[model samples]
Target: MPAVLVLLLLSGFLSRAEAATVVARVDLSSQRMTVSVNGVPRYSWLVSTARRGYVTPTGVYRPQRLYRMYYSRKYYNSPMPYSIFYSGGYAIHGSYAVSQLGGPASHGCIRLHPSNAATLYSLVQSYGRGNTAIVITR
Candidate 1:
C-alpha cells in the first residue's frame, strides 16, 4: 500500500510538470508574438523583429537566459528590460520605441512594448526555463 501511494504521487507530479509547458511563438511575417500555455492562447502582442538589412534567425529554441534588467553593450548601451535571450545575442525584450512596433525595426532582437515584455517575463519566470519554448517562424 505504501509503494502504490508513492507511485501515484509521483505520477501526479509528472503530469503537472508536463502540463506547465509554455510556448512562445514569434511570426516574422506578421511581426507578432503569441504565448500559449498547454495549446491555449494566453497572450498576444505586436513585436518588431530584425529590419530588412538584419536577420532574425527563425527556428525553434529554448530560453537560454533571462534578465529583469539588461543593457546591450553592442547596441549603443540601450536598455533591454525583461530580456529573454533565446538565440545568441538576440532576445525578446522591451523597447522604448513604442511607435516602431508592428514592423521590422530592431537591429536583430525581437522588440515588444515595455509593459507587455514585463508581463511575458513574469509568465516565463513562473513556468521556468525547463518548461518554456521559443519558436521563431516566418
Candidate 2:
C-alpha cells in the first residue's frame, strides 16, 4: 500500500511537470499577475488592467507575438516595452507609469513594472509561445 501511494504521488507530480511549463495568470479584481513554471509559482507582481469604460478580456490565450520594444499607434504612440500580445490589440507590457500599477489604469492592456515585464518576456521567449499560456480571470 505504501508503495502504491508513493507511485500515485509521483504520478501527480509528473503530470503537472509535463504540462505547460509556463503560465501567466492575471486576476483583474486583485490587480495582480502570477507566473508559474511547472506548477511552481515563479513570479508575482502588481499590475494595472483596464479602467472604467475599457475592459480587459478574460480568457485563456497563448502568446501571439512578442516585441521587446513596441509603441502603441492607437494610443498616442505610447511605449509598451516587452510586450506579449495575447489578444488582438491587448497585451501584457511594461509601462512607464510605475505609480499607476496595482489598479485599473490601463486602456485595456495589462501593465507591469518595466523590469517585471522584461523578466516575463524573457520567460515566454525561453519557454516558447506555444508552451506558455495566459489565463486572465476576474
Candidate 3:
C-alpha cells in the first residue's frame, strides 16, 4: 500500500511538471484576454486593443523581458508597472485607468487591470523570464 501511494504521488508531480509553461490568449475582435495553466483557464479579463486603424497584430510571441516599472512617452507622465515586454515595442502592462478596458484604445499593446497585471507579473516570474508564450488571434 505504501509503495502504491508513493507511485501515485510521483505521477501527480510529473503531470504538473509536464504541463505547458506558456498560457495566454488574446482575442482581437472581442478584445478579451484569457490566461490558462496547463490548458485550464485561470483568469479572464476584458482588454482594449489598438484603435481601428492601428489594429493589434495577431501572432505567437514569447515574453522576452520584464519591467517592474516602465513609462510611456505617449501618455506623458503616465507610467506602466509590472510590464511584460512581449513583442517589439508591445507589452502586457498595468494601466492606471482600467475603466477603458473592453474598448479599442491601446496604441499597440495589451493592457490589464493594475491588480491583474501584478498577479500576472508574479506568474511570469515563476514561469521564468522569457519563457511565457502569448498567442493573439482574431
Candidate 4:
C-alpha cells in the first residue's frame, strides 16, 4: 500500500511538471511574443520594447513577480496591468498604448495589449514561476 501511494504521488508530480511548462519567447527584431505551453505554441502577439534611447536586455529569465496592477515608479506612475516582472525593473505588462505595439516605444520594458497581458499573467500564475520561462532574443 505504501509503495502504491508513493507511485501515485510520483505520477502526480510528473504530470504537474509536464502540464505546467510555459514559455514566453520575445523577438526583439520583430517585436513579437510567442507563448507556448508544454512545447506547443499557444499565442503569438505583438510587443513593444525599448525606444530609440533605451535598451531591453536580452536573455532567458523566469518571472520574479506577478501583479494584477502595478504603477511604474521610474516612468511617471504609468499604469502597468497584469504585470509579470522578470527582471529588476523590466517586465511584460499591459499597456494602454495599443497603437505602439509591434514597435519599439517603451522606456525598456516589454509591452503587450491589455488582454494579451492578462492571458499571460494568468498562465504564469497557473503554472508558477519555476515552471515558466521568459526568453528574449534579437
Candidate 5:
C-alpha cells in the first residue's frame, strides 16, 4: 500500500513538472515584455515593436522556432540574435538599437536588449516549445 501511494505521489509530481508554462506578454502601449513562468511573473523588460507605418500584429501565439543567431534578408541583413519566432516572419529578437527600446522602432518584430533576449530564449528553451506562449497586445 505504501509503495502504491509513493508511486501515485511521484506521478503527480512528474505531471506538474511536465506542465510548466512560460509566457511572454508584450504590451505595445507600454513597449514592455513581461515574462511569466508557470503563471508567476518572473521578469519585465523594455522592448521595441513596430514604428510609424509598420504594424506589430496583436495575438496569442506559441513559439514556432528559435534561433541563436539570424540575419534578416528583408531588412539590410540586420542581425537578430536569440530570436523566438512566434508569427510568420515576426520574431522577438535582440536588437542593437538599445536606445530605441521602450518605444516603437522595429519594422514589425518585437525587439529586446541582447541580454534580455538571451534570458527569455533560455527560459523558453528550458520549458519546451509546447509549453511556451507569446501574447502581444495593445
Candidate 6:
C-alpha cells in the first residue's frame, strides 16, 4: 500500500511538471533568462545577447517557425536541431555548451541550454504552434 501511494504521488508530480507552461523572459542588462510557468518561476539561466552595439530588440513575438534540423555551413559548423525562429534571423535554439550563455555571445537570437531549449520547443509544439508568444525585454 505504501509503495502504491508513493508511485501515485510520483506520477502526479511528473504529470504536473510536464504540463507546465514555461514563459521565458530575458533581461539584457543582467544577462539572465527567467522561465516561469503559470506565473511561477520554474528555472533561471544566464544568457548572452548581441554585442554592445547590436542589442536584442525588445518586443512581443511568436514562434513563427520550427526547424528540427538546421545547419549553417557558412556561419557555424554545428547543426542546430529543434530551432524556433521567432523573428527575422533570430531564434531560440539549442546550444552545445551551457558555458556560452550569460554574456554578449549571440548575433541577435536567444541561446538556450540544449535541454532547456528542447523542453521549451516541445512545450510550444504541444501547446499550440502559433499561440506561444515570447516577450523579449530590456
* Colliding pairs, model 5: none
In order, what is each prediction's RMSD in angstroms?
8.1, 6.2, 8.2, 8.1, 8.3, 10.1
Tens digits of per-residue lDDT, candidate 6, 75-101, equal: 666666678887877878877757878
Candidate 5 error regions (>4 Å): 1-20
Better of 5 and 6 by lDDT: 5
Per-residue alpha-carbon lDDT of model 4 for 1-138, expressed as tens digits? Answer: 223223323655334333337788899999999998866789999999999999999877789999999999998999999999999999999999999999999999999999999999999999899788787889
Q: lDDT of each prediction vs. the true structure? A: 0.84, 0.86, 0.75, 0.86, 0.85, 0.67
> Which residue pairs overlap in candidate 4's backbone?
none
**What is the C-alpha lDDT profile of model 1 across 1-138, one tens digit per residue?**
223223323646334434436778889999999887756788889999999899999876678899999999998899999999988899999999999999999998999999999988998899887677777889
State, as a TM-score between 0 and 1, how close model 3 is to the true structure.
0.80
lDDT for predicted candidate 6 compared with the true structure:
0.67
lDDT tens readout by residue for model 3, 63-125: 788889899776685688998888777888988778899888888889888888888889889
State which candidate has the highest TM-score. Answer: 2
Q: Give stretches of model 3 more than 4 Å off.
A: 1-19
lDDT of 3: 0.75
Candidate 6 off by > 4 Å: 1-22
Query: What is candidate 2's lDDT per residue for 1-138, written digit by digit as tens?
Result: 223223323645224343556788899999999998766788999999999999999877779989999999999999999999999999999999999999999999999999999999999999898677787889
**Number of backbone collisions per candidate, in order?**
0, 0, 0, 0, 0, 1
Question: What ranking emerges by TM-score with the best candidate at the front?
Answer: 2, 4, 5, 1, 3, 6
Model 4 worst lDDT run, 10 consecutive residues? 1-10
Give the per-residue lDDT of model 5 (tens digit) for 98-118. Answer: 999999999999999999999
Give the C-alpha miss distance for residue 102 in model 4, angstroms.
0.7
